[model samples]
Target: MTAPRASIGALSSAEFLPQRVSLLYRLSGNDVPAILLTSAIAAFALWGYISDKLLAAWLIWLVLASLVRFVLKRAYRLRQPGPEAAARWEGFFCLASAFVGTAWGVTVMLLYPEHGQFHEILLPFLIGSVAMGLPPALAPSPKSFACLIVPIFTPLIGLLFTQGGAFNTSAGILILVFSAVLLALYLSSNRALIETLRFGRENERLLEQVKEAKDRLDLALQAANILIWDWDARRTNVFLGGNWAIILRVGKETSALNLDELAQMVHPDDLPKVKQALDNCLNGGESEYVAEHRVKTLAGGWVWSLSRGRVVERDAGGRALRVTGVNVDIDDRKRAEVELLAAVQREKELSEMKSKFVSTASHEFRTPLATMLSSAELLEHYSESLSPAEKANLLQTIQGGAKRMSEMIDDVLTLGRAESGVLKLNLGPANLRELCSTVVSEFRIAQGKQHVITLDDRFDRPDVIMDERLLRHILNNLLSNAVKYSPPGSEVTFSVSRRNEQAAIEIQDRGIGIPLEDQPRMFESFHRASNVENRPGTGLGLAIVKKAVELHGGEISLTSAVGSGTRFTVMIPLRPVKQPAGVS
Candidate 1:
């Protein structure tokens, strides 16, 4: 068996061997026509000089050799061998080449004339032409080229030298020199072909690897919900990729849009800032463009996105030519931040409310405590010397102060329950007219001639299902505030009416009304109007009333001016009672 052929450059890497073998087969297949033509011409040239039988046999042998090469080429195409079988195929090719070379070499010995000068010259010349034409076709495999040239030239040169004449000797020397030159040319051509094939295979592999890497990067970007974009500043167009369709709720056909088209999808409120940031980067005022803004989605909603980019390419004049960037979904993060800020503000406001409660409670308790103490001391020291009227007056004053303190304490506790979220509705049936009448009578008795409190019961359906306890709290505080804030003998109207399915309770008092600026926060815990100067009260009444109203699934609103008095309207939904429970 022939020794396994050495791989190209001694680099026996499996990848290189298969490629070299394939190129050898391709070059050989292309030379089939040239091989047949050359053999026919050489046979015809020598037909006249040799005996007919000898010439015919030589021609038949050459035809058989060429047929063997054609069969090998056909077999290689059908088998399609891998790298491991490369050497086997190459050896077969070299063997076929050696057979063809031997047929050519036999031409000189078979056709040479002993005394004919023309036949001698013609035989060598025909053999030399065939030998020189082979390097280009056989260059893919140096071993194959060697196999062909050695056999073809050896016979002709040996016959010339052994003739022992000056002409014969000179002819043999020149053939030897020509064979050496052809061998040199074959080696050089083979090296160049192998190098080119190796480089081409390397390039194909690199390109495949790059394509795979890009596919992986695209998948990663899609998973992360990141949108990549490229801006061609000169063309004023933007190309979007990487999850853009899913994130923007758009179609793939619209992936590329002009700058104006892209801007149209931006939120109008946020567009200016976005444009400024991009312009700054393009103008070289900033190294990178970054902005958090709202982008309008195809569904007609806005999404918050954090866009970041930089000028990737620029012209010689420093104008941006291309910008590359990515957009990350930040809608959820922005919402959380907004909620956090509101919570912080609420906490701060609660802190301030606590401080105000402490200060106001201290001052309110002092006045009532002083009144009770002074009244008690006067009765204790002057009971024996005082008349019954004087003694009764002192006792009454002490009782009044104690009642005021109890009311203040109740208001604070009610407000506390509302703030803690522990206040619940106790639903029951009650009479709207009677409840209003009761609250008005109580206020009338409490303030004798200071204010005239009137009740107008316009609600025909007075019986309704509600949280009566909360309703009482609502009415009592509103009426009490009306009577307390109004001037002496001012008319305070308490009107109860039914508006559709709701009970509307309006209490209008001609009093020192809330200031416009302070009205918005009037129901806040421990918050009082700025105009209520020297008013003897804790600021918890209206706050407690507001909370009670809310628990009853109702709303309370006020209309007020600085000197024209305030009107408070409480609208509570009239939920019907299905079962008998309790009455407030």
Candidate 2:
């Protein structure tokens, strides 16, 4: 995870020698000559007493060298040492050093003509060696050797042709032979050194490749979260690593792996599919065998794994001899898939239920609503001729039908609010005992002798906070359903109580109760049980009650069994209905 550090020693692998050496490395061409002049001055300071004329001659060469080197340094615009750009600058340094040594050799040959032949040749040899030892891209191998050879051989040619001092025929032959021998030695040594450098560079390159490959493999194994496996189908041997045991929940016993052991982990339902995939791989009928299946864990849980692989080698019969692959944990992905499918199925069911509700509501509400409207029109026309009793009964018939129609319309609106998630609440202070008594009184008048109703006001009436309209709708639905389903003269009780910060109301009915199977879906929109078919009801009544109670921050629950009485309880937060002092 840490970043690789740049090599500081790459630029200065050789120890610091002197400013002259550093300058010689940084500059190129004639700039190198200036460093040589500085170096010559330093050398002469140590050996100046040897001869005055020799020192003066050296000084003259130094002045010429310094002037040439200054111009070349300016033209090259050389860089200094740093990590960001060490290689490029250091390479230039090597080139400059090569040129410096060459220039110095040239200066020595030109000035000291009387020096022995061996000495004259020594200068050129050192120049050539410096060039060959550095990076070869700068001052090429053949060129540096050729240049040095020219200077060394020039003296030999002079000794052979000139009729002056130290130039007899025999001496000329010896000089020529010496030059040839030195050239031969330089060539052989140059070849040998180049071979050694080539071998070293090849080994370093191979080592780097191997290191990089190992790093990649290690990272892949660690980060992939997959169990890598290899199977030799012909040999009946398999290899697996990368935490297969942990994925299978084998309690840290991942090391012992065989065909039978692997089979034991597979789920009974998925074993056939896994066996088929393996059979195909072994028979040479398939190059790839991949499957997603469940495998039972040691703790009785199950894991979903995606196994994928391809034939790594084939035998003479074309059957797979080896296959390499991986098994990836896919339990989370499988669970998400199942959840998505269930959600889609539920959505389909809900859509169908909504359609059925619309159909039933249109048919059932139209008839009663039409009858109420017609009765109202007829009653207005016959008002003058009708007896007092006749008038009252007709008026009551119209009112009752109209009220029922209104309740059905309210149920539809409440369902819409529940679905849209925009049901509004208007919270205010209201008395719990007064609220229950009022609901019971209305239901008693509505039901007449068909149901006997009682109100139980047991809770503290210090007031509770609730949305008045929504709470009324909730109580109305429960009381109406009780009245509709009860036998003639059955008792329906309304009770109110307070607990902690909330108030609860219960509407209990002695009626044919809900079956156990239907209880779970009683509050779903448009859901009605089969036994309640002839009850003259829209199933939206209880659903609307649930939504209305929830809108006022309440919960509604039903407890019932077939043939027993049913109880519907509504609980709302008291904070919404708490009455102020001096208020009813």
Candidate 3:
């Protein structure tokens, strides 16, 4: 199970020689304190004997104290060791171990056998016991164990070999052979420890690789509501990705879903085309499948989606077996396309309306201009040959034609302002009775006194706030329509009265009433009732009346029965809301 050198990332890898060496020192760090305490107690017990050698003993104590401080600091560091911390701990532990080894080595000379036989055997036994204990604690890093044990034992064994005597020479040879045996044991234990660490490190590296690949795949699919599908067409089964529940919003119910179950979610209208695309690919008519369709959501609503994929596996006959691809949400793009089409359609209708209005205006203006020009030419050529009465009649005809042309132009301009939401209101107190009286008088003169125009004011109060110009147009247009559409002697009644805070006016006429179907669109510009046969009119009158009544804060309505008569009612507030600043 040893980790391959090729797979180890760097010296940072846990199985690397230096990496294992550093871990070994960290594990042995706790033993340093125990060693310090034991050594201090032993030294103190021998203090009385070593008093003459006090300076040397004190130096050893100071070095041992420094080693204790360095050991504790490195021990704290290894509690939560990282790569960088391991390297730092190794340096500190190595320095402390070397110092401890050198101090014990010095004991061979400082506490030498020159003192007595009791010291000779006792000192070597103490150092030897400590050296032999190292192999287990430092097995993870054999180089570090050698650094301490070699220094401690080499001096004793070397001295024994150099001494000139049969007994001493035999003991030196024996010590040399023991040292060789210990080295062999250390090498064998170090090999086993390295192998274990290398196997564990390799397992950690493989697990990390798997997690990273999974994370990247999840990120790619999340960006646009993507769902993966693996279809086993031959078996009529489907297996979606692990992220299927998240993408489709199916909650935990995704377990039982299959290809046929998902197909049922397709909108009815789009299902046929969707099925055809799938058939083309599955039946070998096409190599790939692509379709945009509506799919039912968890909320029981349909959302647009585009699915794309190709056949990856097939039988010997090229019969499709597996198909895999993605379904991506595309609802926003579909909505934008629909709105743009509607906007284009509206612009086309407006263009056609403008052209129709132009044609109607030209024909309306020509009749009035022709009358005025011909009347003026008659008077100019026949004035000298005719009497004063004849000349005055021609002048009256010319004046009437000029008034007709002016009224047509005013109607066009008034309708334009009303439609644009910028009607000008000259609001003030007005005599409702007088306004009705004037409109009646003008209609009587224009119709040659044939139609009877009556005004009835029933208000307790006469004064009212209103836009005078717009109010006049409301009454005049209604009155003119009544007279123009009726027989020569039909009666047109205009009544003004105060009903609550409103000045209610009614214009009634015994004329051909508006048709049943045309009443709804009566106020639309350029619209004329279907029953108005051969009536010379611009059809702008009622449209302008509707706008004028609205501007004065009033409502206008009518009731008509064909072949009977029509009655129009208008209500204007006596004290309407105040206008915006500078509005007249």
Instruction: Judge candidate 3 at residue 82 and give its lDDT.
Output: 66
lDDT string for model 1 (418-487, tens) is 8899888888789888888888888889899888888888998857888878888888888888977899
Specify the highest-lDDT model's number: 1
Top-scoring candidate (TM-score): 1
Q: Looking at candidate 2, what is the lDDT of residue 467?
A: 75
Question: If scored against the real structure, what TM-score would every candidate get?
Answer: 0.63, 0.58, 0.57
Cα deviation of 327, candidate 3, in Å: 5.6
**Per-model tally of clashing residue pairs:** 0, 11, 2
**Any runs in candidate 2 off by more than 4 Å, and if so which?**
1-272, 284-287, 294-307, 316-319, 325-347, 366-392, 576-584
Model 3: residues with Cα > 4 Å off, grouped in runs: 1-86, 91-268, 286-288, 294-308, 316-319, 324-336, 373-394, 417-468, 471-532, 539-584
C-alpha RMSD by candidate, in order: 7.9, 11.9, 9.6
Q: lDDT ranking from best to worst?
A: 1, 3, 2
- Candidate 1, overall lDDT? 0.80
